[model samples]
Target: MFDRATTFGEALEDPAARSILERYMPGIAASPMATQFRGGRLGQLVALVPALEDLAERERFFAALAEVGDGAPRPPYDPAIAPDPAYEPDDVARGSAPATLPGPTPLWEPLELRFAGPSHGNPFVDVELEAVFTRDSGQVRVGGFYDGDGVYVVRALADTEGPWSFQTRSTARSLDGITGTVEVVAARDGAHGPVQVDGFHFRHADGTRHRPLGTTAYAWTHQPEALQQQTLATLADAPFAKLRMCVFPKSYLYNADEPDDFPFVGSLAEGFDLTRFDPAHFRRLEQRVAELGALGIEADIILFHAYDRWGFADLGPAVDERYLRHVVRRLAGFANVWWSMANEYDLLWSKDIDDWERLAAVVGEEDPFGHLNSIHNCRPVYDYAKPWITHVSIQRVDVYRTAENTDQWREQWGKPVVIDECAYEGDIDQGWGNITGEEMVRRFWEGAVRGGYVGHGETYYPPALGLEGEVLWWSKGGVLHGTSPDRIRFLEQLQSEAPEGVWDPLPSDWDMPWGGAEGQVKVGYFGFNRPRFRNLILDDGGWRIEVIDTWGMTVETLPGVQRGQVRVELPGRQFMALRLTRLED
Candidate 1:
């Protein structure tokens, strides 16, 4: 019998134990690290690796070994971890709904039909449910998911205002052959529907310009209830329009606490049931997404990440597909949702490019709305030229050159470049987490002028902000203590005033980063290069000039309208920009 408490040399005699090592720590069978680890207790291998020191990681590693070894307890099923599904059938027939239920459902809002079906056996894996929603424009096929206790739901969105009908088809007898009708009405005011790629930029479904001023708070939802509420309250006033948040609770540096809930059934002390999902966890997520929408923010939801103490990141191909489909089925109807395939996806070493492509295909196939999709990178950037990729989500590959290459990447991919993880403004010990507030503000302006977007994060040590625990703004979504947000807000206001299609980088000197349309507007940002006076090449026309103090949030206009090829006076300060607006005669 294999034993984790015994030395790995003894455990290696059992082929099953060796196989477990090969599965998790690939290449370890022939690696030098194995030789060192093999001399110690098999369970002590985690201690050899400094990165796996956390309670969750330790529990996960030993549990894996125990699962394959002797006397392994059966997989756990905790009732508290599983909650009642969020569906209740009304006075309708068993497999059918009323022909017309309600009137004038808003455009792009979900129309849900719940049916009581077979709860026996694995309904999650056994049942297949789908419905075709037909309207005046066309018919869209939407997939439905199995909620617990025999409840199956078919949720669909109507883009046009008209009477829409839907009929369900399922493998289960009780779920199949259901029919219903909903009256689709005009979209509510400020309801822009989902964001879509518009050439090198983004726009809403109704063609409104959407420049993504995003920020990252990877595990905000997994925090305590009070902290989650605080995060929402902070976000309500912050200038960020999009949030890069993770679907799974993160397990990494400064993030060791057991989450209030998990996506799968079972506790961290016990392993999760891969076949089942925690519906309450998803319901909480939905409520958070809805709340974010109410505050006019887009949820750039990350589906996978490598900072996992749970085994969600290491799920097999079949289970991965099932999980992806399930998430898409539930959240696709939300107009504010954007699917980020993963955060630093390459860090998930178990997966390859092919695996990512298949998962992306599942999202495309399952989501009827066709929400924006992209994968973030840690080191090797994913080839964004793939047809399925809507835009490029990136973490700077090189330190010191964060958002400076925005224009180059935009040209290379012919897509919008979002620098989602340019080093954050913080006082932390890690280099990636401790850039100055001024530097963060500079990157924001630099990226904006180059026809790209940059994301913000904060990692100030908790005590520095006079708080108790590790509640950094980057991962935990606590209050922001950095000075970048106000400057970024100023930058956003300037961007909002500029006309559409204005911020594409124009030909300029290597030192100056500038962008504008030919005859409308031009903004030249002199980042760190504080020139007292500079000659600007402009079209021969009357122009109005304003010197902007990006840091101070002040705009000063010169004496009068200036003509072509003028030498403009500047403050000779860092984080200063010159704006030129063509004076229409």
Candidate 2:
């Protein structure tokens, strides 16, 4: 908006443009990005909106730019106006609603309203349906999804206790102008609805703490029946509260095989009908997800991924909407679902930032339960501060300092940080899949004590797990060979004992010293450092210190230390940590 230059050349050279670029992207704005704009493809500009420090100022800058012209952003949905139910559709049917949802729906559980719609000329693309559910709290406009067989469904979440009313609007006469009412009851114990971001921490809808000790098993569902069973069984006792898996099969470095089944009905060739979904594949996935929920694991369902031999990653916007809508209908109903937009969104070379946003809108429009949403990264982290993103799902770009930057990321994003993919633990060929188990455990402790959720993965050498030489754990998810899982489980136990289970990053003096709160508890992790003894100056006395051999899996409490100027001893080895807690009495 600052001095609109008639030509791209003038705009790139303008001092005003330079200032604007420095404020957002900086450094690159005047150089490569400016050159990129000069060459064309200006819509890539909206990706810079996340870099702005002020949330309100981004709107001011966008107000003047042309629609996708010179990189102007396509605005994300305003949570307020986007949910309003005032918009009317073409026809309103004044017919009897076919025996609504049986009885009272549980609070936070999805109350699905089904309708019969026209099956003419590709129902997935032609038909459009929406609903508005109103309670004393407010009204939310939810979009309807087609379930393959001329059936349209709308799922809505009840936030409060008591009766909630709703009205349906549709483009076709089959499912419009109908209204219904249902009672909302309390949520089942331990079923805390969906997970939400609560000020740098993740919590359940019922306000219960969710100390996320997560792990990744990418193509677990694509494995054999016996292997899949083994993975689920492993998860039952594994120290993971959250699991990251893909909706689509992964085809990458180690994994070269096709999945057991694809989500779509047709082949992976171009021009295939994405509108028609494979119900069998979805049914199988739903079973697995339900199993995960029963085992108390939050399912971080990755919708789109780039590593592919199939054409699933290259669908257009219209078909993408259909795919996402069905996904919301089928998966979002689960209380343990968290939507990861893509595994590495940037790698989807066909998709721009705007395309990803449109898909995010479909999630917001269809998922009434408001599940936690985030997009993971490969190189540069997707601007995690975006409005649509609920938390930071980070795949560490830096090999050595990924988990170490947990505090920095938490401070920057002001959201719960999940280091979703920091390298894996194994003796495999790939650099990413060959870190020692000790380093993996050390990474978890580093992120754990720094108030970030670190994710784990295993990729041991093949034939080592009593299986074929090619199907590795990182890709196949059969069994665990590394020792990091047990160590990570121990970290979870330590976090559970604290009332303030969610940790916050504090200023570090030693090898990254972190505190639970206002000096109630403190942890100092000497990652690769090995100091025998150190002197601590305490302002207040009653603090107890324990020597923690993180990899050795031992906790030894050191006694006979006085109030001020206490002496603390350590193992003087790698992956050693010290836990200091102030005694109540």
For this target, which candidate reaches the highest lDDT against the unseen true structure? 1
TM per candidate comes to 0.84, 0.81
Per-candidate RMSD vs. true structure? 7.3, 7.7
- Candidate 1 per-residue lDDT, tens place, 1-585, comes to 443345677656677767766655455555876677665555435433444435475456556666565645434322221222323234423464322244668987777767767676677767788988888989899998876866777667657788888878766554557777888888989888888898888888898888788899999999999999999999998999899898889998899999967887888788888778888898899899989988889999999987877867767677788888888998887889999999977667446677889999999999978889999987767889999899999987677787888999999999999999999999888999999999999988888888899999999998877789999889999788889998988888888788883378877677887786656888999988898988876677888999999899999998788886888888788889999899876
Off by over 4 Å in 2: 1-100, 116-120, 269-271
Q: What is the lDDT, from 0 to 100, of the residue 474 in candidate 1?
A: 92
Tell me model 1's lDDT, rounded to 2 decimals: 0.80
lDDT of each structure?
A: 0.80, 0.73
**Which residue runs does candidate 1 get wrong by more than 4 Å?**
1-103
Candidate 2 per-residue lDDT over residues 1-585, each given as its tens digit: 332222345445666654554555554565665665553222224333355324355445444333223554333322211221322243444443352453787776667787755565665556667788888788877776666666677766656778878888765655667888878888766677677888888778888889778888888998788989999998998988998999888887778776657788765444345656776788788789879988989999999987777767766566667678878877776778899999877666457677888889889878877889999877656788889899999977777778888888888988888999889998877788889888888888888878888899888877666666576666678778888899998888887766677567766785556646657777778888788887777658687788888877889987755578877866577878777788765
